[model samples]
Target: MKKLLTMFFTFLKIGAFTFGGGYAMIPLIEVEVVNKQHWIDKEEFLDIIVISQTFPGALAVNSSIFIGYKIGGVVGALLALAGVVVPSFFIIIIIAYFFLQFRNNLIVDLVFKGISSAVPMLILVAVISLSKSLKKELSTVLMILLTVIAISVLDIHPVLIIILSGIYGAVFLRKKVN
Candidate 1:
C-alpha cells in the first residue's frame, strides 16, 4: 500500500510538472524512476521508453504503467496510470475553461512561444540520453543515420520505421542465446 501510494505521488509530480508532452517528460521520468527512486535501472528505463513508444497511448502513461507493473503488479499499473493522467486531465479542463479569455492575450501567446522553444531542447536531451546507451559500433551509427534520413529526408512514417527497424533487428542483429 505504501509503495503504491509512493508510485502514485511520484508519477503525479512528474505529470504535473512536465510542461510539454511525452518526449519532453523523458528526462524527468528517467531521473525520477532510475536515478532518484531506484525503481528501475537505466537500461530497463530505456526499454520501457522504447516499448511505450511502440504502443498507441501516451508515452508518459505507458511508461508509468510499465514501470509500475514491473515494480509491483496490475494494481501498481492502475495507480501509476492514474497518477500520470490525473494532472493532465484537470489541467486540460482548466485550460479549456480559461483559454478562451486568454486567447488574444499577448502574454499568453509569448508564454506558449517560450514553451515551444524549450520543448525541442527537452526532446534533444532525451535523444542524447538514449543515444548514450547505444553501442559505439558501425552498425549502430549506420542505423542511427539511416533512421534520421528515413524520418527527415524520406518523410517516412515513424510507425513504419519502427516496424521495419524491428524486422531488421530480428533478421540481422539477433544475438546467439548462450
Candidate 2:
C-alpha cells in the first residue's frame, strides 16, 4: 500500500510539472525511477522508452504503466496511470474553460508561441540523453543513422521504420555461436 501511494505520487508530480509532453518527461522519469528509487536499471529504463515509443499511446503514460506494473502489479498500474493523468486532465479542463474566452488575446497567443518554441529544445534534451545510452557498435550507429534518414528525408512512417529495424536487427545484427 505504501509503495502504491509512492508510485502514484511520483508519477503525479511528473505529470503535473512536465510541460512538453512525453519526450520532455524522459530525464525526470529516469532520475526518479532509476536514480532515486532504484526501481529499474538504466538499460531497463531505455528498453521501456523504446517500447513506449513503439506503441500507439503517449510515451510518458506507456512508461508509467510499464514501471508501475513492474513494481506493484495490476492495481499499481491503475494507480500510476491515474496519478499521471489526473493532473493533466484537470489542468486541461481549466485551460479549456478559459481559453475559449481568451482565444483572441495577444498575450495568450504570445505565451503559446513561446511554449511551442521551447518544446523542441526539451525533446532535443531527451534525444541527447537517450543517445548517450546507445552502444557504440557499428550496427547501432548505422541503425540510428538509417532511422533518422527514414524519418526526416524519406518521410517514412515511424511504425514501419520500427518494424523494419526490428527485422533488420534480428536477421543481420544477431550474434552467432562459435
Candidate 3:
C-alpha cells in the first residue's frame, strides 16, 4: 500500500511539472524512476521508452503503467495512470475555461511564447539522452541512420517504421538463448 502511494505521488509530480509532451518528460522520468527511486535500471527504462513509443497511448501514460505494473501489479498500474492523468485533466479544464478571456492578454501571450521556445530544447535533451544510451555497434548505427533517412527524406510514417524495425529486430537482432 505504501509503495503504491509512492508511485502515484511520484508520477503525479512528474505529470504536473512537465510542461511539454511525453518526449519532454523523458529526462524527468529517468531521474525519478531510474536514478532516484531505483524502481528500474537504465536499460529497462530505455526498453520501456521504446515499448511506450510503439503503443497507441501517450508515452508518459504508457511508461507509468508499465513501471507501475512492474512495481505493484494491476492496482499500482491504475493508481499511477490516475496520478499522471488527473493533474493534466484538471489543468486543461481550468485553462480552457479561462483561455478565451486571456487569449489576447499580453502576459499570457508572452508566457506561451516562452514555453514554445523552451519545448524544443526539452525535446532535444530527451533525444540526446536516449541516443547516448543506444548501442554503438555498426548495425545499430546503420539502423539509426536508416530510420532518420526514412523519416526525413522518404517521409515514411513513424508507425510503419516502428513496425518494420520490430520485424527487423526479431529476424536479425535476436539474441541466442544460451
Q: What order do candidates take by lDDT, descending?
A: 1, 3, 2
Model 3: per-residue Cα lDDT at residue 66 = 97
**Residue-wise C-alpha lDDT for candidate 1, range 1-178, written one tens digit per residue:** 8988999999999999998899999999999899999999888889999999999999999999999998779999999999999999999999999989999999999999999999999999999999898789898899999999999999999999999999988888887322
* Model 2, total clashes: 0
For every candidate, C-alpha RMSD to the true structure in Å: 1.1, 1.7, 1.3
Find the 10 residues in a row with the least total lDDT in model 2: 169-178
The Cα error of candidate 3 at residue 126, in Å, is: 1.4
Going through the candidates in order, what is the number of backbone clashes in each?
0, 0, 0
Q: lDDT of each structure?
A: 0.93, 0.90, 0.92
Off by over 4 Å in 3: 175-178
Candidate 1 Cα outliers beyond 4 Å, as residue runs: 176-178
Q: How many angstroms is residue 171 displaced in model 1 relative to the true structure, after the best TM-score fit?
A: 0.8
* Ranked candidates, highest TM-score first: 1, 3, 2
Q: Which of the two candidates, 1 or 2, achieves a greater TM-score against the reference?
A: 1
Residue pairs with backbone atoms closer than 3 Å in model 1 (clashes): none
**Model 2 scores what on Cα lDDT?**
0.90
Q: Per-prediction TM-score, please? A: 0.96, 0.92, 0.95
What TM-score should be assigned to candidate 2? 0.92
